[model samples]
Target: MRRYLRLYKLFVLQYLKTLMQSKLDLAIGIAGFVISQASGLVFILLVFTQIPEINGYGIDQMVFIYGFSLLPKGLDHLLTDCIWWIPGTFVTHGGLDKFLIRPLNVFFQIACEKFQADALGELAVGAALVSLSIARGAAELSVLDVMLFIVAVLAGTVIYTSVKLIAATFSFWYKNSFHIINTIYHLNDFAKYPISIYPKFIRIALTAIVPFAAASFYPASYFLDRSSLAGSIGIAAAAAAVSGSAAYGFFLLGLKSYDSSGN
Candidate 1:
């Protein structure tokens, strides 16, 4: 564990050095992400202009959920987003052969190959929105609420990573699973609001199939005092544990089928 951590630190340093060579490009990318996130929020604001609330959630609560969703999503994007490149770029272009030859874990090697700086913009915006909602008295959190929110965020990050991993693992057979990964990942947009607003089938799909609701809706609902604390925490934790374990197991299984490109 210590060795891996040290190696990851080294990787981060090397990645930063590379990024520094193109600082302007990095800045533009981050700025683009910030603009994109702001646009989404603007769309939400426009929707609320026509209605008092969506379901039982007010504008502040909805924004809180949206911001809370970004925390875990941004963390996953920052840390494990390289997984998304695996199927389409790495495997298809034989870039994965280099990682397979390394002494380190292939997944670890892939993850450490690059650090996404654009995700910092998402994190910044997310924090700002959450702070805004809190300052407006949208939710009054106790110490336990704060602690549980942290846990929920961590669990949600794992859930996001796990889903991406599972989708990427499909590349072992498909050779490219970008479409599947994108479809599943984009489902998080629905999770930014209350799941109750959706149809029963969509609700079930978000909760049971993709489990995006577990990553944001359920956890944020609990934080906002819209759901039972124990139930929310339990569901989020269990979803994280089950999804993560299943995804890792699937990845290991798929790894056994990996065929080197011999490049």
Candidate 2:
């Protein structure tokens, strides 16, 4: 474990060096994400202007959910963004060869390859909006609430990563599953709103299948006192564990079939 941590530190340092060498690119990436988040916020504002509430959820509550979603999304994006590369061009281009030749675990090596600075934008905007929700008297959190919030966020992050892994692992067979991964990941956008507003099928799918609702709406509902703490935190943790285990199993199966471009 110590050795693994040391190697991860090295990976982080290398990425930092690369970022320092491309400061302008880093700035653009961060700014681009920040602007994208700002645009989403603007859309939410426009939405509330047209409708007084979305399925009994007030603007403040909806915004709280939106902001809460970003916390887990940004945390996952920062750490495991490299998985995006796998389904994009890495598998087809034989990039896994380099990792396979090393003694380290392939998934660990791939995940640690990059540190996404752009995610800082998401984190910044998310924190600001959640704080804004509190300022608007949307919710009051006590010490225990804060602790549970942290646990919820961590579990949510795991769910995001596990979902990405499940999508990206398909690249082992399809060679380039970028479209699949992109389509699946974008579904999280729906989680930014109240799931109750959606149709029964979509609500069930999000809650039980993709389970992005566990990451955002459910946890946010707890904070807003719109749902039970047991249901919120318990459901989130359960989903994370189940999905994470399933994703890892799928990844192992995929790795077993990995042939590289040579095969």
Candidate 3:
């Protein structure tokens, strides 16, 4: 574990040096992400203008949910999103062969290759919206609530990372499963709203199958007092543990099946 951490630190430093060569590009990417996030918020505001509320959630509550969703999603994106490229470019083009020759874990090597600095925009926007919601009295949080919120965010991030890993792991067989990975990931957009507004089947799929709701909606619901603290936190923790274990197991199975292009 110490060796892996040292390797990751070196990888990060190299990536930072690479970023320094293209400062303008990095700035532009961050600006673009900020604009995109702001546009989504604007669309939500327009929706509230048309209706008083959706499924008993006011605009502030919706914004809080939306913002909370981004915290985990952005953290996953920042840390592990390179997993997405595995299916298309790495596997198909035999780039993964290099990782197999290295001493470090392949997944850890992939994760530390690059950090998505642009995700900072999402993180900043999310924090701002959550603060705005609290300032406007959308929800009042106690000390316990704050502590649980932190745990929930970390657990949610684990869920997001696990889902992505599972989706990408299919590349071992298909060689190019980018579409499958993208489709699975796009489900996260639904988590920005209350899951109650959806049909029973959709709700079940989101909560149990993909479990995006555990990452965002359920956690936010707990924070807002719409659900019991124990139930919400328990579900989130269980989902994270189950999904993470499943993903890691599947990844190991896939790794055993991998056939390097040199073979």
Candidate 4:
């Protein structure tokens, strides 16, 4: 484990060097995510202008949920962005061959292959908004509550990684599962909101099927309402464990079918 951490640090340093070389591209990438998030925030503000709250959540609460959701999603986007390539061009063009042959874990190599600095924009905005939410609310948080908050966010990040991993692993069979991956991954957008606005079917899909709600609404609500703080965090942790285990299991299964450059 120590060796893996050392290698990961080295790989990340190399990637950072390459990333810094392209200043214009880096700025554009960060700006793009910031704009995307801003647009969502604008929509939320406009909606609140028309309605006092959505199912008991005020504007501040909405911002909190949106920002809370971004933490895990942004971290996942930064660390595992390379997984997208598997279904895009890697499998067909032999880009995955190196990862397969490497002595390191296949998932680790893929994760360390690239880092999306653009996600920093999301993280920055998210932290700012969550702070704002706390300023506007969350005034009674205790030390233990703060610790649970950290646990929930970390678990949510795993859920994000697991979802993406499962989607990318399908490339081993589909050769190009980018569309499938995108469709399922974007469902998390719904998770950024209260989830109560959606119909029962959609709610169930996010809560039980993809379970993206666990990464956002469920955990975010923990801060907003302390009625079930520990319970909420537990659900988020459980969701991460279950989804992560399933994704990893699927990834192993997918590897069995991988034929380098045979796609």
lDDT string, candidate 3, 77-176, tens digits: 8899799888876677777888889887888988986788888888888889999998998899889888988999999999999999999999999987
In candidate 4, what residue range of length 10 has the lowest lDDT sum? 225-234
lDDT (Cα, tens digit) per residue for candidate 4, span 71-125: 9999999898988888766776878787777788988888888888999999888
| Candidates sorted by lDDT, best first | 2, 3, 1, 4
Model 4, TM vs. native: 0.95
For each candidate in turn, the TM-score is: 0.96, 0.95, 0.95, 0.95
What overall lDDT goes with each candidate model?
0.88, 0.89, 0.88, 0.87
Q: Native-vs-model 3 lDDT?
A: 0.88
Better of 2 and 4 by lDDT: 2
Candidate 2 has its poorest 10 consecutive residues by lDDT at: 87-96
lDDT of 3 at 18: 88
Residue-wise lDDT of candidate 1 within 1-263, one digit each (tens)?
A: 99999999998999899999999989998898788898989988999999988887889998999999999999998998799898977777778888777888988988887799889989888988998999888898889889998999999999999999999999989986899999988989899888888999998888778888999989988878657866687788999999999999999898888886766
lDDT of 2 at 101: 89
Across 41-147, the per-residue lDDT of candidate 2 in tens digits comes to: 99989988999987777888878888999999999999999999986556888788888889988889888988898899999899999999988988998899889
Q: Report the C-alpha displacement of residue 103, candidate 2, in angstroms.
A: 1.7
